[model samples]
Target: MTWARIMAPLSGGQGDPPTIAAAVALAEPFGAELACVYTPADVADVMPWMGEGFLGGVQTTALESLKEATAVGEGNARKAAAASGYAKTHFIGLQTPVWAGLSAESRLSDVVVFTSDPARGRGPLAEAFQQMVADEQRPVLVARPGLKVGGVVAVAWDGGKEASRAARLATPILERASRVVILAAPKASSRSFDPNRLKAYYAARGVSADVEVLSDSGDAAPGLLKAAGAAGADILVAGAFGHPRLQEFIFGGTTRTLLGTDGPSLFLSH
Candidate 1:
């Protein structure tokens, strides 16, 4: 089935432009409804950490900041530069915690697209994104603003459940792409990991794909990126490995590594 609904969590900042535009671009092809969720940082939970109280008095508390964020997010998304067409767009301002808001929205969406920050791995925003992915049974696309989503579709296929889920979850995007390439990081040969099987799977679904085996050499991330780049893929879909919290907490694993890459926007599922 195609993606019928897309949820984008906007924090109402410089990152909004690209993130909203990217989500709109992806959703436009399928006429998916784009729900822009405005998330404001909860001041009450964080104000105690402000330490000095110097910039505190003027700083917005939870309720007021959320209203402002929602208003701005709605305005920006309504006039999203690249977002055009008959696809419906709406803004939703949530009062719940970041994790809860993202979680609730995710439940109503086929996929959640949002801007990701690599450097702020341990921050509240980062944790919320990670938690959303981990706690919910939904797909998350970590997108960089301004990056286009089309052309060749790249899938990092290892035949694991997460990878399989990712491939299936990415069906909507894959159907819209011009081509599909299933890139596998080959280690000692294993019967379980067959890129051909994945290609065939896509074929049955009306999406054609080719299989390429890249050397394991050392790390899987580099090989995956190299193959994907060579194939001119504008987007990379991969299975997330490890617990989201542990991975983000230590800033390690394939998910975090790829998130930091300058390659393509990521379509990841846990």
Candidate 2:
């Protein structure tokens, strides 16, 4: 299935280029509706609540800050639209909290993009991105710094519902991939996991595949990373937990292990 409505949230920062680039590339090929959702800096947080006597000063400063932020977002969105070859169109600037706006937008869009750089600024977008993937069951493309548009796309396959869902949602991207690999290892002894079906699925769409069963290293994330690198993959597709607790969300199983501190762009689904 192709992503027809794609939303890329631009959190004006050092890591924005890679995030925007990936979104544009993916949307361009499919002729999808690419929207640059510009969420301004949370001014209310930066500006403190003041007494009525100081209301005038607060209002003036807030207005100027908002205007400046909107201008920057519009400028960036224009450049991105041009780079991606999408039409110069309606660029909506939302004055809302990062988390809330993104969550709401995610509901309307087929996919969202974010830079997987774990070293995020003090803004809440990073965590919100993670939460969206974990809770929304939607596909998120987490692009790394210097991410190329398309290349080797690897699937972290474990023969589970989430893994299957990730593979399904990423099918369009995979169809155009230069190479596709299934990073699988022994999971449940009762179940036999094979990449043949997945490989054939892609082959039907003209994409070839390779399979490597990582040596049983109880923890699969590291092995998966090594295999993906060996295959020259820059984009990793995987499944995320439905509701990882705060700590687990930050540091626990495969999803956390792969995402911790950011290494490669992750395309995740729940």
Candidate 3:
């Protein structure tokens, strides 16, 4: 498996620079296209709540404000992309049906890129990040500062469907990794599985990997992070376990812990 395109949704906020830099780093290794999409607030979402009795002038003013914000956001996003100096970058500004356009872009791309702020629900792209990971079920790269793609990669496995899917989708990245390590905590998980099986799976794809069995612990995230840091890993590949809760998605305990830490960039799939 090879990546041909990488999508990064920018909210025209402070996170755009790091997000674009991470996207460019990933794309450079595979000579992939970096699709930087501008996502602005949609005016249509607020129209229904304005009620039928709202004044015409108030509605017009609101619409105008949204339009102005969109224009400014697009300009900021474009500037960020250009500053990356990546030749294969493309900047796209979504129209009225913004969510639909974002969905289409993510569907066609090999993977979506997001910064930690958004993943932690502390940035403008938080909602879009949740939509991509939980709702659209797209492969995502939760990038951190100084992100690198073709470095030591760690995979967290527990013999679950989500873990299997994440490892499979991350094959291209693993293939390019200088070293691959499979971190397993059989005692931490309820499922019984062999880490060697995953190592062998990677061998079939011409990728060599080492297996490290973590000591028994109630929580696995801490162990996984410690091991990955010890190995000087650039990215950790894992399943994003979460479910929708009201307007937000609540991640599993382990996943939430990993997301909260600033250790390594995460390559996750639902």
Candidate 4:
């Protein structure tokens, strides 16, 4: 099915612009609706965190910060949407937890887009994004800010449920891709399923795709990066894997590696 709606979260940061642009570009051809949602920090939680007899001062500061953040986020969203040629735009002020609001909104949309933070090394926001991927049951695209994307595209396929889901969600872009590469990581056991199924699928959609199986003993992110570079791909598409909590505890291994690495921008789904 063609994408009809796209949901983007505004988290009081300037890093979401590229993601917003990508989402709009992907949605425009399909005449999809674009909605931007911002999550304000919880005031109630701030009061408890304040020191003894400092509740009033903390409350005032927190409210001011929240207001500023909301204004900046909303303004950025509007500007980005307009620049990206989105026919319609929405600004939603979230009263609940960021993840909860995003999850709820994602249910109503075909795709969700999120930005990755490199300095904090994948903080709560990344976790929330991953959780949305695992829980939303919809496609989620995570884009790193400041990355220029176009041209060749690579799809990391392991024949898992997540891979299949990602491939389906990325069909719109894949259809327009100049070159599509399906990189299959080596597996120990012999399997009947062929990764060529995806190559054939893209070919049917009028995309020129080449399939290859790579034997690498290194990590998945690095291996994928190498393959993408060799294929001259400017965009990488893959299913986000690994348990969120485990990745967090390890300071964000797979996701962080992909986001921080020097390569083409990645489109992630779970």
Candidate 5:
């Protein structure tokens, strides 16, 4: 129930601090530890064999760019941790792959916050970030580039174990929410559980709950986003999808799409 540790990735972008700050603010009330993870560039010791006509100058420039990027990333992470007044900050400069470093650190943390860099077009990093989300199987808070978080909250529910876990983890935040909405996405099955079952469950815990069932649609992200907007939800809580091994192999499409889409800050748990 308590957030003991928070892991945040740093990539030397201006957007990282706000994301980290939001997470620290959320965790500070609970006395959670903060850990900052940075991925350093991999500088190969052996230069690739090229013909005499090959341009060695281009290779040198690429190496310099890598070094500069790594340094900037490390500096940004440190600045963020210091500015946030995190009690404990762990800076990991790993020469290994980004995903490997993230996976290793994620295992040691209670939750991980993945922030996107607007300057860098969402590509491999986005994919890796989504993989981290699925791989960790822990709570993840994804902050949009420039979103202010406050007010109503929405919980995307499906009456499953993952949904239950998300609800439990979000209880602390939900308890303080002025309004809470539980969204149920129907599945294809012979028998389905009642959405009010979840609503009543939260009501019993002293939280005001509004339950709504979303019809089965090929695309749920857009509808969910629209609902959250209409509900004035500044924070969206949902369960991270995809099986453990499958997540490692193939990223969750819904999670990836959600991260990319605009709306409120997301609180996700697996």
Candidate 6:
């Protein structure tokens, strides 16, 4: 399974540069199209309450302001994409139904790319990031600064459905890594599994992986992070876990901790 299209959603702000650079880096290895989509706030979301009686001068000015902001954002996004100097890059500017356009682009792409800010739920595209991973169930690469694909890649495995799916979807990337390591913490997990099983699975696909069973220090996240850092992994492939709460979504303990880290980019699937 090779990636042919890499999607990066830009907010037309300071974050656009790193996000587009990351997308270009990921796409360079496979010669994939770097689809840089400009995602501005949907004006409809803000003007929904400005109907018949409320459509006064205030409403008119508000609509015009939103349109102007979108235009400015599009210009910024286009400039950022062009600055990347990637030959196969495509810049997409969306209309009023921005969310729908973003979803369609993400659905058609092999994987979505995001900067650390969006992954940490602290950026303009934060909501879009959540929707792509949890709601849309797309594979995502939460890229760090100076992103590179061909390096030591780590796989966090537990034999669960989520981990299994992540490992499977990340096969193409794993195949390209200089070295692959499977980090498993059996004591921290309630399930019974073998790390060598995953190692053998990768062997079938021409990826030689070493199995390392991490000492479960009560919580799994710390151990996993330590192991990945020790192995000098540039990317950690794992599953993103979340559940619906009363009015919000809460990420699982391990997933949350991993997302907060600074190094080792996360290649996640939910």
* Model 5 Cα shift for residue 36 (angstroms): 1.8
lDDT (Cα, tens digit) per residue for candidate 6, span 60-145: 88888888988999999999999999999999998768888888999999999998888888978988888888878899999987
Give the residue spans of candidate 3 off by over 4 A: 53-55
Model 2 regions more than 4 Å off: 41-85, 88-90, 97-100, 118-124, 145-150, 187-192, 200-207, 242-251, 261-264
Tens-place lDDT digits, model 1, residues 1-270: 688888877665566666677778878878889887766666455656656653545554644665566677656645653354434887776664655766788898998876667223533356556665676757888775445555788999888888899999899788878889999986722435778988988899999888889877556888888888899888889877665454443433676678777787788887
Give the candidate order by descending TM-score. Answer: 3, 6, 1, 4, 2, 5
CA RMSD of each candidate after superposition:
4.2, 4.1, 1.2, 3.9, 4.5, 1.4
Ranking by lDDT: 3, 6, 1, 2, 5, 4
Q: Of models 4 and 5, which has the larger lDDT?
A: 5
Best by lDDT: 3
**Clashes per candidate (backbone, < 3 Å):** 1, 0, 0, 0, 0, 0
Superposed Cα deviation of residue 163, candidate 4 (Å): 1.9
Off by over 4 Å in 6: 245-248
Misplaced by over 4 Å in model 1 are 47-87, 118-124, 188-192, 244-252
Candidate maximizing TM-score = 3
TM-score of 1: 0.81
| Tens digits of lDDT, candidate 4, 1-270 | 467788876654565566667667656767788887665455555656666765367667776786676677667656765665566666676764655776788889887776655322454255556556655656766554344334688998877776777887787777766778898875521343577888888778777788878777546678888889999876788776655465342323555677677677677776
How many clashes does the backbone of model 5 have? 0
Q: Indicate whether candidate 1 or candidate 4 has the larger lDDT.
A: 1
Once fitted onto the true fold, the runs of candidate 5 whose alpha carbons sit more than 4 angstroms away are 42-68, 85-90, 95-98, 116-128, 145-150, 187-191, 203-206, 215-218, 242-257
Screening candidate 2 with a backbone cut-off below 3 angstroms (N, C-alpha, C), the clashing residue pairs are none
Higher-ranked by lDDT: 3 or 5: 3
Residue-level lDDT of model 2, residues 1-270, one tens digit each, is: 567777877655545556567777667777788777766566665556543554467677776777687678657755654565456323455664655666787898887877655323235366556556765656888777655546888998877788889988888888778888888877522357777777777778777888877775577888888778788887888877546676224433676677764566788888
Of 2 and 4, the candidate ranking higher by TM-score: 4
lDDT of each: 0.73, 0.70, 0.91, 0.67, 0.68, 0.90
Model 6, poorest ten-residue lDDT window?
A: 241-250
